[model samples]
Target: MIRMYGIKNCDTIKKARKWLEQHQLNYQFIDYRQDGLTAEQLAVFSQQLGWQNLLNTRGTTYRALPAESRNNLTESLALDLMLQQPAMIKRPLLQRNDTFILGFSAETYQQLLED
Candidate 1:
């Protein structure tokens, strides 16, 4: 089963959920806002997906950060910050077994389901 982590209100997450439902794929939706994350979890995600991919630079949370807070951030610091503020995570993180994917599109989801 796919374990999906994301905020409930994000458009990208909505698209991912719709795609899964359309494909009859079973998934567990974890609302990051409600459930939250730990620094260790974020670190693990960074290792798998990379901080560059995990960070939501386009999101308001990221853009609203102080310049100094945003600058000179190492991967460990970024992971810790993301854990403190789950809104900093990219949307629609889908995990199966240990394989993880961020974001969604019909074609990519179709390929994943087939695999």
Candidate 2:
């Protein structure tokens, strides 16, 4: 089964969910807000896709951080921060099998959706 992780209020997540439904794809939505995320899960995703791809530096959550914290963008540090604030991470991370696509996009979903 596919696992989609993101906040429920994000517009991108909304679009991704809509696309999945329209395509009749079955995916378990994991909202980090309510359910929260484990450090082990973060480490696994970071290893699979790297922290750079998982972190959303341009997001409002990132921008709101202190300049000093923002300046430090190391993988370990970023992972630690993201583990605390999942919202700082990218939205609609679609995990299927051993691979995952962070961030939402219909094109990516189309390519990965079950056929």
Candidate 3:
């Protein structure tokens, strides 16, 4: 089963979901704010896709953090921040089996899903 993780109102997530639907691909959507994210699940994502890659440093949630919390960030600190606020994680985290595709790109999705 393919699972998509992100906030419902995010434009990127909306686009990704539309792409999936247009392609007639079935997926399970997990809205972090509504469904809740677990520490274990976050750890697994971090392990598979590096903490830095999973973290959304450009998002308002991360930028709004104090300089002390945002600067010189360690893996543990980043992961903790992401866990506390799932919005701090990158959007449209698509999971298929053990493989994860972070963010959305039509070309990338087509290639990955075709494999």
Best by TM-score: 3
Stretch of 10 with least lDDT, candidate 3:
68-77
Which sections of candidate 1 miss by over 4 Å? none
What's the lDDT for candidate 3? 0.93
Computed on alpha carbons, the lDDT of every model, listed in order, comes to 0.86, 0.88, 0.93
lDDT of 1 by residue, 6-58 (tens): 99999899888988888788899989888877677777788899998999999
TM-score of each candidate structure, all chains considered together: 0.93, 0.93, 0.96
Model 2, span 1-115: residue lDDT tens: 8999999999999998998899887889999989999999999999988898899888888899899988877988899989988888898899999879988777777787644
- After the best TM-score superposition of candidate 2, give how far the Cα of residue 60 lies from its true spot, in angstroms: 1.5
What tens-digit string does per-residue lDDT give for candidate 3 at 1-115?
Answer: 8999999999999999999999999999999999999989999999999999999988988999999877789988888889899999999899988889999999988987887
Q: Give the Cα error of residue 21 in candidate 1, in Å.
A: 0.7
Best by lDDT: 3
Native-to-model Cα distance after best TM-score fit, residue 59 in candidate 2, in Å: 1.4
